[model samples]
Target: MSAAALLSPSAPLPYSGAITDVAGIEVGHHTDPRRPTGSTVVIARDGAVAGVDVRGAAPGTRETDLLAPGNFVQQVHAILLAGGSAWGLAAADGVVRWLEERGVGLDVRFGRLPIVPGAVLFDLPMGDARIRPDAASGYAACDAASTAAPAEGNVGAGAGALVGKLFGVPHAMKGGIGTASVKVGGVTVGALIACNPLGDVVHPDTGELLAGARTDDGTALRDTRRSLLRGDVPRPLLAGTNTTIGVIATDAVLTKVQAQRLATVAHDGLARAINPVHTMSDGDTLFTLATGRVPLGEEAPGMTVLSVMAAEVAAQAVVRAVLAARAVTTAELAIPAARDWPGRRAAA
Candidate 1:
C-alpha cells in the first residue's frame, strides 16, 4: 500500500501518535512503585534488522557492538531502555532470558540466544539511588508488551528523568517518555524517547523553549542556550549522570547499513529539539529497527525519504515527552512539568 492509500479518507489503520503504530512492534513499560525509576522494552518477536548510534560521551550500553554492519548479528529480538545509570544495563539480561524461553533469538548450535541490545540513562539522583531497575523489571516490562499505545510521561525508563539540568538538578524540570509516528511513501517511521538531557527541550519548528533550567526563584525558565551564550558558566555535572536514549523503528525494507544510516541521521532530530545535546554528561544514544514490511524500489531514494521522516518523528517525540510529564515533588526538591510553567501556559 502506498503512503497515500494508508492516509486515504477510508484508510483502516489510523495513526496512534505512538511508536506502536509501526507494524510488528510491541511496547511495554515497568515503573517501579518503590521509586520513580523503571525500564522499557521494545519487542520484535519475529526479529528485525537493527542498527545503533551512540553520540554522547558517557554512554552505558549493552550488546551495541553487535549492531555494527560488519558484525555477525544482523537482527535483534528486542531493545531495552532503562534508568539507573550503569546498573540499568543489567535489565537486558532478563529480556534475553525471557526471549530465550520463548524461542526467540539467533539460533545457536545448542540453543536459541536472544539478541537484546540496550542502553541506560542516569536517573539515580531523582529518588532512592540504590533502588534501580533490576532483572525482574525487564521481565515485567516484557510481560506487559502490547501493540496498544503505551503510556507516556513519568513512566518506564523516563519516570525519574529530569531535563535542563545545566544549573543543577534542583533547577531542572521533570522529563519523561514520549512517542510519535509518521508515514512516508509506503512506510511508517516511529520514535520512542526517554528524554533526560542535560539541556533544554525546544519546539523544533517554533524555536520556543518548552522546558529547561529554571531561574533561581524556580518561577521562570532560564533558557540554557542563551545562558551559555551570555558566558554564564553552569555547575559542573557528573559525567554519565544525565542522558537521553531512544529507538527509531520503521516498517520499511532496509539493509543493516541503511538502518545504521537511519539511526545516524535521526540524531538531527535530537539536535533540533534539544539545546546542548550529546554533551559529556549526557549519554545520548539511538537505535534503529527495520521490520521489512514495506519495500521501496530504490534504496538510495527510499533512504533519503525515510531518514527525513525519522528525524521529524524523533523531534516530535521529544517535544511530546516533556509536554506529557507531570510535576514531581519530594522532600529534597520539587520539579515542575512543562504544562505547569506559567509562561508556557500563558503562551498556549
Candidate 2:
C-alpha cells in the first residue's frame, strides 16, 4: 500500500478544527494572576486510550513512562498542562482528586486511581516566582471544565509564557494557547498547544517570521533562525526558561502504538512554526488521546492519516497562539503583542 493509504484508507486531510470535535472530551483552565501561572485540564470522564511523546532536552513531565505502548494501563482519566515548570506538576494531584471524587479512573482493589499524565513549561520570570500553580489550581480547572471551545492566548498554562527568548527577555514576545482541528475521512483530529518556545515562531508555508525576538527598538521582528545560521549567538537563557506543551485528541479508535505515532508526528507541526524547537531550554511535549468512538471499518482511515493531519494542525495552532497572544507590560518588562508589530494589524 502507498504511504497515504497506509496512514488512512480515505481521501485527503481537510480544514482546521478543535479538539472538542472529539465527542466526550472536555477542556478547562484556571489562571492564577498572582503568579500569572495556572493549569489546563483535559478530561475524558469515561477514560480514553492515551500515549505521549517528549522531545525537548529539558522536559518536566509526570507519569509518562506508564504511557509506553507496553505499559499496563490502557486508558487515562485526564491530562494536565500547566505553567510553573516542575512546581506545576502539583496540579496533577488536584486532577486526581477531582477524578476520584467523581469516581473516574482505573480500578485498584482498594480505591480507583485516576491515571493523569502531565507536562509543564516555565513562566516564573513573568510573574511572582514564589507564587506557582498548586493543587487548588488543578481542582479549580476541573470545576471549570466544559465541552465548549477552550479560551486561547494567555490563559491556563500559556499564562506568563514567552517566546523568542534567544535574544533575551527584552526582545521576547508573549506566547499562549492555540487550538486547531481537521477532518481526515470520517475521523476528526484536533490539537491544543501552550506555546513558549526558546526561539522564534515562523509561518510554516511562507517561512515568514511570525513572532519571536524583536529588534532593539522592539517595533520589528528579528530572525533568530537566520542569526543562528550566521553564528550570531546570544547569551544562554536561564534554566527552565522555555517549553511548549500540548494535546492531540481524536475520535478514531487506535492502539497505544498508533497513538504514540500520532504524537510523534504532531511534533513536526511544532517544528514548522517554532524556530529552534525542542531545544535544551525547552521541555516540548505532546500527548494523544483517542476516544475510540470511531471504528476502523473497511476503507477506514487509520494512524497515518491522523499523523499527517495532526502535524499540520499542530503547526497551525502554534501560529494561532502567537497571533492571539496579547502584549505583557510591567514596570520591569514590556513584551509587544503580535498586533503591535509595525504594520502587523494592517497586514492581518
Question: Each prediction's TM-score against the native?
Answer: 0.93, 0.92
For each of the candidates, give the backbone clash count. 0, 4
Off by over 4 Å in 1: 1-16, 298-301, 343-348
Residue lDDT tens for model 2, 31-64: 9967567899999999888989999989999999
| Candidate number achieving the greatest lDDT relative to the actual structure | 1
TM-score of 1: 0.93
lDDT (Cα, tens digit) per residue for candidate 1, span 1-348: 322222222223333378888899999999999888999999999999999999999999999999999999878989999999999988898898889889998888899889999999999877778998889999999999999988888999999999999998998999999999988666899999999999999888878788889887777888998888889899987999889999999988888999999999999999999998999998999999999877776442377788999899999888878877888887687888886556441111
Which RMSD values do the candidates have, in order? 5.5, 6.7
Instruction: Output the TM-score of candidate 2.
Output: 0.92
Model 1's lDDT to the true fold? 0.88
